[model samples]
Target: MAIAASTSSPVRMKRRSSAHYRLRRRVRKGALGVLILLVLAYTLFPYYWAIVSSTKQGAELYTTAFLPALNFSYYRQLFDNPVFMGSLLNSVFVATGTTVVSLALGIVSAYALGRLDFPQKRVVLMAILMISIFPQVAVLSGMFELINALGLYNRPSALIVTYLLSTVPFTTWILTTFIREFPRELEEAALIDGCSHFRILTRILLPLMGPSLASTGILAFILAWNEFLFALTFMLTDENKTVPVAIGLIGGTTRYEYPFGQIMAASVTVTLPLIIVVLIFQRRIVAGLTAGAVKG
Candidate 1:
């Protein structure tokens, strides 16, 4: 009887212990929820402020509350500015050119590194990775001289080529990692079907890597779009100035006289496209990151 009673006591104690553990887990979960909410609010506050300022007229912007006013005259005025349109177009051209060139080079280089066994492959990959870590300012003078030698200064091509220094290594590394994960049997089967290497890459591997490519391409585009130093140095004409340079030039009066409202409006406009891109490929970006981490 005592042995049976001791066994029942242990069972009862285990049940109570489990219930207490569940209660503690629920409390921790609730606390974690509150912490996440606070983090999200903190992260989003700057964007919220920018949106509020964009909706206000210039006069109301300085005088108004943190919340947005019902007026949107500043947004209208910002669009009316000629520089805005010109800068927007320049940004588009530069971003598109950079994306195309960077992706083309990255695809070729990544394929070579990931698939082909070569002497000094590790050395070449290490060199690319190290080059990517070098500061842009450190290479600016060399880039400028190179651009001048090629007579490409003040052209969109100059910006595109310069951006490759930043975009190419990361893109190649990411895509190569993704490419390596593809089953070797698939490529072998393609070869058995009399598909050439180029045909297999173009028709099979490239199609499968669309998501990884898009994620890297969009990232390159955004980097090129937001680039300021090279854009300022390479592009001299007002018409060639990308949005970052344009925005910088817009606010150089006295601090008191800065066009905060218009700046905010332009900020919102510039950020809108990036926000859309991120939203569109958010899943792909997540997948690409995961794949790179696992495969690389």
Candidate 2:
């Protein structure tokens, strides 16, 4: 009886430990899931509220709720305004142009910086980082001067040019980090096979950098899309205004009237493209950011 009791005591201890470990794991997982739910709710709640508010009319705007009564009057007002439609178009054009130009310049700059050893490389990189941190307001006067000198005021080109200040630096930094981690042996092999630099860039490195490209491009697009200071400063005429400026302008003739309905409607409308882009390329963004961070 004593021998049997000793064996069972150890067995009971093992069972208790196993159950304790499983319980701890469940607690941890439950905590993590709850944390994720909270973060998601915080991030998405504003978008949800905007969508709900867009469905409300003048009277309904006063009634705050998660779900609102459906009405298209605000949308109708937004669509009926020629200025609003033109601003949307302008935003798209400027954002797309900025993405293309920045990405193109960024890839070339990144390749040069990442793959080459040159004098003043660190200085150049530090300069870019410095420029990025400079307050937009500080550079506003200089940029306006440059823009006017270049005959680009009130033009989409002005916004595109100003946007490079934001996009190019970001794209270049990310691409440089990512490109630095690519296998140099492959480039050497391509060179041994008589591949020119441009051909190697186009054929070899680019396809491999797809995820990084998507990540940087989408970020640049979002920045340019949502930028207000440069857009408002450069594009003065109502016809040339971008979505942010136009949304700010969506009010009644007098201070007494608050056009919350139309403002919500325009906000919802302006946010759709950004949401779609994020949803489509979220994996790419995560992969690129993680890979760059981990490998470097």
lDDT over C-alpha atoms for residue 272 of model 2? 89
lDDT tens per residue, model 1, 1-296: 99999999989999999999999999999999999999999988889899998787656777748878867887787679887788899899989998998888999898888888989999999999999999999999999999999999888788988999999998998988888888889889999999988888899999988789888988989999999999999998987888999888886357768787778888889999999989989998888767757543
- In candidate 2, stretches whose alpha carbon ends up further than 4 angstroms from where it belongs are none
The per-residue C-alpha lDDT of model 2 at residue 91 equals: 94
Question: Over the full model, what C-alpha lDDT does candidate 1 score relative to the true structure?
Answer: 0.88
What tens digits encode model 2's per-residue C-alpha lDDT throughout 142-258?
A: 999999999999999899999899789899999999988989998999999999888888999999998999889999999999999998899889999999999997778688998
Model 2 earns a TM-score of 0.96
Show how many residue pairs clash in every candidate, following the order shown. Answer: 0, 0
Cα-based lDDT at residue 23, candidate 1: 100
Alpha-carbon RMSD to native, per candidate: 2.3, 1.4
How far off is model 1, as Cα RMSD? 2.3
lDDT of 1 at 11: 97
**What is model 2's C-alpha RMSD?**
1.4
Tally clashes: model 1.
0
